[model samples]
Every structure is written in structure tokens, then in C-alpha cells.
Target: MLSAEEIHEIEAEAQHYPTREAVLIDALRIVQSHRGWVSDDALRDLAEFLHMTEADLDGVASFYNLIYRKPVGRHVIHLCDSISCWIEGYAGVRRALAARLGVDFGETTKDGRFTFLPIVCLGCCDRAPAMLVDGELHVHLTPDNIAGALEKYA
Candidate 1:
């Protein structure tokens, strides 16, 4: 499942650990890099590699939003529907994003290029209606701005 180069990199990183278990995070990252997300089979392989139980490794992956347990679209657009963003004007932003992506929240585009998810906050309360695209935050969102900015990604 891994190439010689990837195995070399993985082993190099694993070597730094006093215990192979210490490499769980790095292993998960490598797996994600190769597969774009962590599948059950991948996590099991990761568990075996780390000398840990699947549940143990899975707990860590599931706790972090950065790790994708399920298949996701190519681009993940997390729109902040937090109280602050809502008070400002998140509805319009949400609508714009949904329309631009041609999929509703928690859905992948038919072409599998984009997905929409709602986030509680981006910690940019001052910039309400803020949203994140591929982990990059954008502030002061409007329908026009959101639609215009998403053209290239679409």
C-alpha cells in the first residue's frame, strides 16, 4: 500500500520514536497523504504498525476534525455558522456557498470536487460570516464575494 520512497519516509519518522506507538500521529498523517482520508482498513493497518489497538488509534483520529473518517470531496468548505457569524450574516454566505458548490451542507458535489460543512467558529468573531476553505479562513463574506472567489475552485 506504500511505495519504497513512502516506506523510507515512514520508517525514518518511525525510527525517531522510542516506541513505534509514538509514531501514530505521523502514521495517520502519512496515510491521509496517500489516501486523502483515513479509512477503517487504513486505521487498522496504522494500529498494527504502531503496535496499538485499532480503538486506541481510532480514538485519536476521530477526536480531531482535521482527520477525515468518511469520504470527503476534493475541497472542503467549512462555513462558520457560529453565533458571531450568524449575527453578522452567515445565512447569505451559506446560501452562496451551497449554490456555488451545487451541493447542500454535508454533501459532496456530483463531480466530487467540493463539500460543505458548518463550523461553530473560526475564532474570527470580529470578522463575522467568516468561513474556511481548505483550512484557509476568509472574513467579511458576502454572496458576491463568496461566489466570485469560488469560481476558480469550481
Candidate 2:
């Protein structure tokens, strides 16, 4: 499920680890970096390589919010839903985004261009109602400006 280059990269990183179990997160990240998202086959291979049960590895993988288990679009939209954002009109921002993308959180656009997801925070509380589009942070959002900000990603 992993390519030679990916295995080589993962093994090189694994050298610094005390044991295969310690390398769990990095191994999964390596697989995700190469494959976009970790498939069942890839997870199985990783479990074997790490000498851990698939269930154990899956638990770890699922715990990390950044690790995607299913296919995602080219761009991932992470909307902050923390109290600061909530107080700063997060509902309007979310509504605007939902209307713009025609997809709700945990759903991907039908055109496969974007995936909308909710994150706890982006640590931009001063600039509340922030969102990250493919890692580019947009803060102090309003419904009017959100669409323009997303145009670059589209």
C-alpha cells in the first residue's frame, strides 16, 4: 500500500524512534502525506510494520483530528467553532460558507474542490470567526468577505 519512496522516508524517520510503537504517529503521517488519506489497506500495512494491532493503530489515528480516514477534496476548509468565534457571529460565517459551497461540515463539494470541516480553534481568537482554507488562515471573517477570500482557493 506504500511506495518504495514512502517506506524509505518512513524508515529513515523511524530510526530516531526507540520502538515501532513510538513511531505510530509519524508512520501514519508519512502514509497520509503520500496517499492524501489513509485507506484501510494502508492502515493494515502500517499496523503490520509497526507490530501493533489494527484496532490500536486505528484508535490512535482517529484521535488525531488532522489524520483523514476518508477521501477529501483538493482543498480542506477548517472553520473554527470555538466560543470566541461563536460570539463573533460564527453562525453567519458558517451559513455564508455553507451557502457558498453548497455543502455542510463533514461534507465535500460535489465538484470535489473543497471539504468543509469544523475545528476547535485556529488560535486567532483576537481575530474571531476565523477559518483556514488549505492551511491559509483567514481571520475576522464576515459573510460578505468570506466568499472573496475563498475565490483564491477555488
Candidate 3:
């Protein structure tokens, strides 16, 4: 359940949107920022708060790729897997990094410091073989760059 203050805060966000329905995404984002994924209770609360049905809220949330409906790693490492990246060395780079980290894609490290995921396009096709770690983009990556890059967050 959301705190009274939290609900009030969300109400302010709700007002900013042209319609209460518009607040659904942002409110769910707020919930995810706090709790990781969109839990059943959070979905129900969001539905009630936004005057939406649970199914309606779920539908919108599921439609968006960025919205995590399940648990994600504390530090998400998104590697670009688009055509440009594939033409580069992203495949080998991804494999080597996974070997070094000892976790498959979408799996979190035991220390919980990292989780590897794939991104369809980083929007930097020119910098094919790029990745985003903790929201910071690292372009033109190689296997050699992985350890040093991981150090920045460590």
C-alpha cells in the first residue's frame, strides 16, 4: 500500500496530466522506482488511484518495454542487440562479458551489483556495440572495456 503522503504526491502528478489516465505510466514508474517491479498490490493501488481498472493498467504497462513487470537487477547493463551492433563485435563482447561475470543475460550477479540485459537499439547505431550501464551510455565497447567500465560503478 502507498503511504498517505505518497498517495497525495501521486495526486499532484495526476493533476498535471490532461487526464487521470495519463498519470498511469508515471505513477507506475514511481512505484517501480521504489519497489523494483509492478507488484500485484501496486497495480491494484494504481488502478484505484487513477480510476482505472486493474486490467487496463496492466495492459498499458505490458505494452511498454521499459516498464519492468518482473524483478530486475539492481544495476541493469543493457547491451545493444540491433543490426548495427550485431555487425560489430557485440555478440562476442556479450559472450565474454557474461563469461567473466558468470551470469547469463537477464540474470543478476550474486553480489547483486549487476544484471545483464539486451536493448533493441541504443539509438546510437553509429556507435554500434554500445551499452548503457546505470543510465550512462558507453559507446563502441569491446571485451577489453568491460572490466574498466564495470569499475566505474563498483
Candidate 4:
């Protein structure tokens, strides 16, 4: 069941849209903000609350990579795999992250510290190799700096 606070926030955001369906993303975000990730039950509750079909809401949630449909670690690492990043040695960084975290893309560390995933871009082409760790953008990454960048998270 959706918490009273979650319902209140969703309702507040709903006022800005013409229909509840229009606020689907925001409603999902509200639920995720409180729960970290959207579970199947929460998805169903949200779909019903917004008068949307579960399939429709699920499609939207899955389409948006930021909306995690399953459990995630405390931190999410979104490594950019754009051509610019690739040119700047994204491979080495990926290797370093995988080695250090012991998890590949789309997988979370066993310690529940970080979930690593690849992103199409981070919009820092000039910086080349870049990543967003727990929403903080890290640019000009090299294999050597991965540890320093992640040390603060724990």
C-alpha cells in the first residue's frame, strides 16, 4: 500500500497535470524517492492510484532507466559509454570498476554498496570518460582515480 505521505505527494504533483496519467512519471518518482526502488506491488498500487493499467505504467517505468524496477544498491554508478567516452578509454575504467566492485554492468555489488550500469551519455563529451555516481557527475575518469572517487560513498 502507498503511504499517506506518498499519496499526498503524488496527489500534489497530480494537480499540475491535466490527468493522473500525465503525472505517471512524477508519481513513480515520488514512490521511488521514499522506497529507493519501485517494487512490483508498489507499481501496481501506483498504477491503480493513477487509474492506469499496470502494463502501461510498467512500460513507462522500464523505458526510463532512472526508474529502477528492482532493488538497487545504496549508490548507483552510471558509466557513460558514448563514443567520446570510448575514445577517452572508457574500457579501462569499466574494467577497473568491475574489478573493484566485483560486479558487471546491470549488477549490484554483494555488499549492497553500488549498482553499476552503462549510460548512453553523460553530456560531458569534452571531459570524455565520465560517470554519474549517486547523482554526482565525475568527469575525466581514469582507472587510477576510481578508488578515490568511490571512497567517499561508503
Off by over 4 Å in 3: 4-9
* Candidate 4 structure quality by residue, lDDT tens digits, 1-154: 8999999998898899887688899998999999999999999999788778999999999999799998999999999998999999999999999999999999999989999999998889999799999889999999999999999998
Residue 99 of model 2 has an lDDT of 96
TM-score of 3: 0.87
The lDDT leader among the candidates is 4
What is each predicted model's overall lDDT from 0 to 1?
0.81, 0.91, 0.83, 0.93
Angstrom error at residue 150, model 1: 1.1
Better of 3 and 4 by lDDT: 4
lDDT of 1 by residue, 73-150 (tens): 887888988899999999988887887777888898888888788887899999788978878888999988987656
Q: What local lDDT does model 1 show for residue 21? A: 74
Off by over 4 Å in 2: none
